[model samples]
Target: MPEQGKKNTLIVIVGPTAIGKTALAVALAQHFSTEIISADSRQFFREMEIGTAKPSAEELAAAPHHFINSHSVHTLFSTGDFENEVLKLTEELFKVHSNLIMVGGSGLYIDAVCNGLDILPDTDLNIREQLNQQLAEEGIGAIQAQLQAADPEYYAKVDQSNPQRLIRGLEFFLSTGNKFSGYMTNSKKERPFHIVKIGLNTDRTILYERINHRVDLMMQAGLLDEVKGLESYRHLNALKTVGYAELFDYLDGNIQLPDAIALIKQNTRRFAKRQLTWFRRDGQIHWYEPDQLTAVITDLESSLL
Candidate 1:
């Protein structure tokens, strides 16, 4: 018997990329007769199909989903925007179903939905302009080193290759003289629905192998063509992602095709490692092997029933 209020549950499935989160989310959605909200930032764009490792057509057809191709690459969808839209969507969905599932490897997006985002002090536009100028002139290493010296904790978890993130952190420190990591505290907002977090993982060697194999599959499935299609949009923040970025460098004649492909695999593996680092800091999530669907269901049933 569930409590009077707080009966609805948001089942959050999170883990490293290529950890079979989509498969588990679809299965759980089928069992609960519910829908899935994607937190994968890259999958929100229609242009990034193969590179994002989105659910296949069959898997998407298996469950109704939200926020998949819901935005254009040209638009900016910040974490705060995601949190607002998801909260509204969850409120509507709970009227029809008692359980809902949200799945992704993007830790900040997932956290924004579940626990609310940490409110940071306002940053100056001038600082942002300066940081962007520095990035253009001195390259990402300059910004990365600044963040590493100022906020090593966030530096360890953030995507280092993403100049946008590095610049944002540095800008915060410059404007407020506060470490970006210090602003991240447990200032959670109350949600009407209860949340149960689930995580999937395997040994490092196996997970790395899975990431490598997924990259190879993406390449075979015309990931290059997808990048080429978005060549004009390469400067957009959306196109500056893992697989896309490496291929863009290849197209720029800065790297060979084989080297780019290899770098994509290597960078993806590193991204997965950072994802794991970010998720592991949260102690509330229950862990499981990707194949442990039965166990996940049993635990959810016991918690929600």
Candidate 2:
């Protein structure tokens, strides 16, 4: 594999939301007799389950899984922390399994683990407090405009709905006289183990339908109650995600329940589009439909031979 004494290989399965990434990852893990390391940012919090679409109990029992729903919402975790933890865990997993599977739809988190993100300078908490005050008084549109003026390229790609993303870009711009996007140049980093990337894709219409249906199912499984339970922590950065954000509006009487549900579906679709854009930028990834598992697995085995 690549050369002599390459150690164990890492199989990374990545795709957009509702692309059946979890199922394929589990299947591949079973085939390889290995455990899974989750890269999902939202799925890290223990309280966020149904909305994050975490792996089911049966699936978790089928293959040993790590890092899913294992953190407290109160604890702040950065991509740098994730990169450190996953790298350490991957080395440990190598002791037992020759091939370890890592999977998720969170493109940035995956990038952090595989290709180290740029370390931005820390921001002043007082400045952060002032920015939060501005966000509260002026709303997201005001912050969006600020970020766009500072880093239009990042504004195009960053999650506009997430205030944390905006704060990060602005913090860097205000502190360093340079856009945060400038620091994130995405130069590849060296890793000790071999990494094999497998991408999953499907027809746009089909993927959208799956997303809509999954949102409906989340509702059926009491996603509204799940959000309601976390209402006390709604302001937490960890809880500020697509499904929970829309439902939070419904909880606050800002929107009708049905409208909030519809908005969740719409936002989820847009998120899928962004995920595709991020993943497509990596030319090293070998793409395939979900149904191409047999051929994909065959190629993976051949690569290690």
Candidate 3:
């Protein structure tokens, strides 16, 4: 428990995929005797269990968790949607718990909740549809090139393979005639609670190996079948992710199963690299090896003091 008269705390555990964030968050939640809110955008859909690497039954049971499999793929949940919901949820949770845990690799969603997102003008739906049509016809590379020319700053940071994000960036530029990255004020919002960010990482080679092994495990766990089940929804923005998108290509006869699996591993590694780049820019995060849970707990205690 926090010391008397101290503000409530939100302990955010952020790292790349396959970096053991779920276990660490659960451990911290148990120690603090509080609940956790998941910031993982991929794990928001209940149908994407195998591919998203969601927490196992045992892990979820080990600690009370919110926002894990809390929505359907059909729902269009945005960063702003998440920010509003989580802020409200945190207010309710803080009424009884002094410390709350949020864990995920989605840097944008994390930033949305921690620092309020900049309000951009509503995008023109006609422009958005046109961009989506272009994406469907010319592939991600075409729109990616557009974003690179229009807004190199966000292009450098965004996951280039994600069509939804590419379209959003392109639509923003087309609608406002300004770079999407420029709209981001990067200003921190004052929250009612204190925040402590803990980042877990390890050697890049080791991280890649872990990612490869995890993908293999996912394949064994019926990730292919899970993708098959969602074939009808492949065009949805929710399915425009690394694992699902690669496998969807295989199902469409665009690539072989083996090639698709390999691409998933490669793309996931790239995603991890991008995640590291995003989090590294935030100097507020305290870095540690994934296994350094004891040291992290000690640091958290001292910070709360």
My TM-score estimates for the predictions, one after another, are 0.96, 0.95, 0.97
| Candidate 2 residue lDDT tens string, 1-305 | 12346577889999999898889889998998889999998888999999999999999998999889879999888888899999999878887777889999877788888888876677667777888888878977898899999899778778777788888788778777887877774587888888999999999999999999999999999999999999999878877778998998898899999999999999999989988988998897999998898999899989977
* Root-mean-square deviation per candidate: 1.8, 2.1, 1.2
What's model 2's TM-score?
A: 0.95
* Ranked by lDDT, top first: 3, 1, 2
* Better TM-score candidate (1, 3): 3
For every model shown, the clashing-pair count is 0, 0, 0
* Model 3: per-residue Cα lDDT over 137-200, one tens digit each: 9988899999999999898888877788888999999998989998774677899999999999
Choose 1 or 3, whichever is better by lDDT.
Answer: 3
Off by over 4 Å in 1: 1-6
Q: Which ranges in model 2 have alpha carbons more than 4 Å from their true place?
A: 1-6
Global lDDT of each candidate: 0.90, 0.87, 0.92
What C-alpha lDDT does candidate 2 achieve relative to the native structure? Answer: 0.87
